[model samples]
Target: MAIAVAATRQVLADSYKTLSGASTVWVSLHTGDPGSTGTAEASGGSYARVQGTWTSGSGGSLSMAELTFNAPSGSFSYAGLWSAATDGTFYDKCALAPSITLGSAGTIKVTPSFSVS
Candidate 1:
């Protein structure tokens, strides 16, 4: 038998709210799972992590403001959240439903969201 631990709605909401309070969240592009250390992070051709602004947590979830990376060249399949622009901390990551492939002159836009259930 599995022991099921359930959290109340308020607890879920609060958890997300706390996450939204991170000081400087950075959004990183990846070719695959970022792993524990944010491996496979995209680089070169103007590719750089962008600072992310998050909406206040609500109803157990929070959303990142849309982020745009200009002139980034890569084939990205995932996005990772970090504490700084470079090497602060790896919080989490998620897969991009369709993935993004950019050439040297184009841009990539993403709006990521988080939730606690």
Candidate 2:
């Protein structure tokens, strides 16, 4: 049986609260699918995960504040959400609509939105 809409909304709301309440939530840039272990994370040339702030979930949806990354010279195809700046917990990942490519001295800014139905 499928989950009820109200139940789904509750689940998403609870999840949003948990994720946003974490001491720090990090947004990571990825060259490919981060996979289960968050592999393929971007590295080198000032690449680092940026901390994210999230808006309150409503109707089973929420959005992350804009994240700015001083990315290295490469192509990024995905983004991952983590529990910490370094190696902590890997929450989830999503593919970029139009993957990002940077030459030298580039910056990528993204505002991620999430929803569950």
Candidate 3:
């Protein structure tokens, strides 16, 4: 199974929950039509609600990379969720509405089983 933990408002701590095998799941947003483009959508199009959980992995936590996908290469607005529990998902500890601007570079380090990748 997948897991999530909250750190802050604009960051999300996700865990692939990988034990012996790597987990793979699709991410969806609740805005645009997730059509024609399969799971991922084209630019500007609204996305479906962000769904699915990544199993807790080595880097069990990750601050949803802000603006990592922003630029001429992958320009788009994205929403994120934050949780507090190492495997919290039942409720949202915090919510990241939507961000599309160029974000400042920073880092968040998770210990024991997680870190910035």
Candidate 4:
């Protein structure tokens, strides 16, 4: 479950006050390529993080976005949200189970939530 953002964790652990709205959110794709350690955030490349249309629901606790790319060029098994349009800190991540192999064109949707639980 890709729930808490890194900033949220920092806030919980160190009382940091950084926060972001849906406008700064973006999604990145990954293939889990061999010799690639999935530790740092994704960057600009074939599997770069792209911005999407964002909407708020459930009193700002829920965020939904869809990324429509002109031509799908890679295979993606994981996805995540970043705090900036490019090269920003990753906020949340989710595993695309069964993986998603893109065709010539398609869209990928992601919904990340925050709650008081």
List the global CA lDDT of all models.
Answer: 0.74, 0.82, 0.28, 0.50
Q: 1-117 in candidate 1: lDDT tens per residue?
A: 322333454455455435536534788889888888899988777778898776645445567779997636668899988877877878888999899877655888999887655
Q: Ranking under TM-score, best-scoring first? A: 2, 1, 4, 3
**Superior candidate under TM-score, 2 versus 4:** 2
lDDT ranking from best candidate downward: 2, 1, 4, 3
Which residue runs of candidate 4 sit more than 4 Å off their true CA positions? Answer: 1-18, 21-23, 33-48, 59-61, 70-72, 103-117
Q: 1-117, model 3: which lDDT tens digit per residue?
A: 333433431133343333213332223221233233332332342222332345343333532322222123232332222232122232211212342332332221111222432
Error of 2 at 33 (Å): 1.2
How many backbone collisions does model 1 have? 0
Residue 15 of candidate 2: its Cα lDDT? 78
TM-score of 1: 0.79
Tens-digit lDDT track of model 4 for 51-95: 654443332243444464332545667766666666666656667
Candidate 3, residue 35: Cα displacement in angstroms equals 9.0
TM-scores for all candidates: the values are 0.79, 0.86, 0.22, 0.51
For candidate 2, give the lDDT of residue 10.
56
Best by TM-score: 2
Clashing pairs in 1: none
Which has the greatest lDDT? 2
